[model samples]
Target: MNKKTKFITIGIIAIFSFTSLFIFSFIFFPNLQTSINSSNDNGRTLQEEVSNITIIIDYSGVKDNEIYSNITLINFNTTVYHAILNCSEIKVQDYG
Candidate 1:
């Protein structure tokens, strides 16, 4: 082939390759986004969902010290699953 044809062929091939990559990314973008955004997931964040709570009473009456009664512990297992399911279902339903 002539130099011009070879250059044109190479250019076309390059363009097609670029376009193919772009289209492929487009097709796989949601999954990729899911994986990437999943790694840095905002969904699995430490939200304030209290699961188990315990209150402590000090008979010594230490008013100067903070009481453990005010402390609250949250377990994410139940809430995370429910929240994830909710968001996934909402996304599937195309809801904002």
Candidate 2:
């Protein structure tokens, strides 16, 4: 092909190769816990059992005003409401 067409074809191939590599890395490596786990499979790590949570609150009397941020961990028994309370200082009337 011409000079310009050849350069364009090379650029497209490079981009495609980069995109494919990025996608495959995630597909194979997956998550941090997987890498940390032992290959022998004696037992699962604590990281695998617990979850990472991030709570965002926006109550500035305006739209999309995220004032408070809380990052905490929760087990199987932890409720969603309790998770939020752990992250922020807010008033909630509980009728139980």
Candidate 3:
């Protein structure tokens, strides 16, 4: 092949490699949230109201491979969380 043709091919290959590198190297993000469940299971009839206890373990810190998690209770159900909080090697910092 001619020197000019070979140089053009090399230049095109270099441009594509550099462009791909530039596109992937700067400020990329991990797509999470797109991974969570979107479907809902109400498990209640139309006349019966839905009952669910949504609790958030807010303000948690882990020490010695154990979690010190806080509970933020959002009650949607008529029933109560009668079960006492239990954990192994728990250091109850504070309950809000």
Q: lDDT of each prediction vs. the true structure?
A: 0.55, 0.65, 0.46
Query: Per-residue CA lDDT of candidate 1, range 1-96, in tens?
Result: 899999999999999999999888887674564643455556455555654433333447555432332233445444534544433333445567
- Please rank every candidate by lDDT, starting with the best: 2, 1, 3
* lDDT value for model 2: 0.65
Pairs in steric clash, model 2: none
Give residue 48's lDDT in candidate 3 (0 to 100): 25
TM-score of 2: 0.33
Off by over 4 Å in 1: 35-44, 47-96
Better model by TM-score: candidate 1 vs candidate 3:
1
Error of 2 at 59 (Å): 62
Candidate 3 lDDT by residue in tens digits, 1-96: 999999999999999999877766653533423423445344332222322334344444553343334423333322223212433333456778
Candidate 3 or 1, higher lDDT: 1
Worst 10 residues of 2 by lDDT: 42-51
Give me candidate 3's TM-score against the actual structure.
0.28
The residue-by-residue lDDT of candidate 2 on 1-96, one tens digit each, is: 999999999999999999998887778776635544566475534432234655667667776755444345556435556667666666978899
The C-alpha stretches of model 2 lying farther than 4 A from their native spots are 32-96
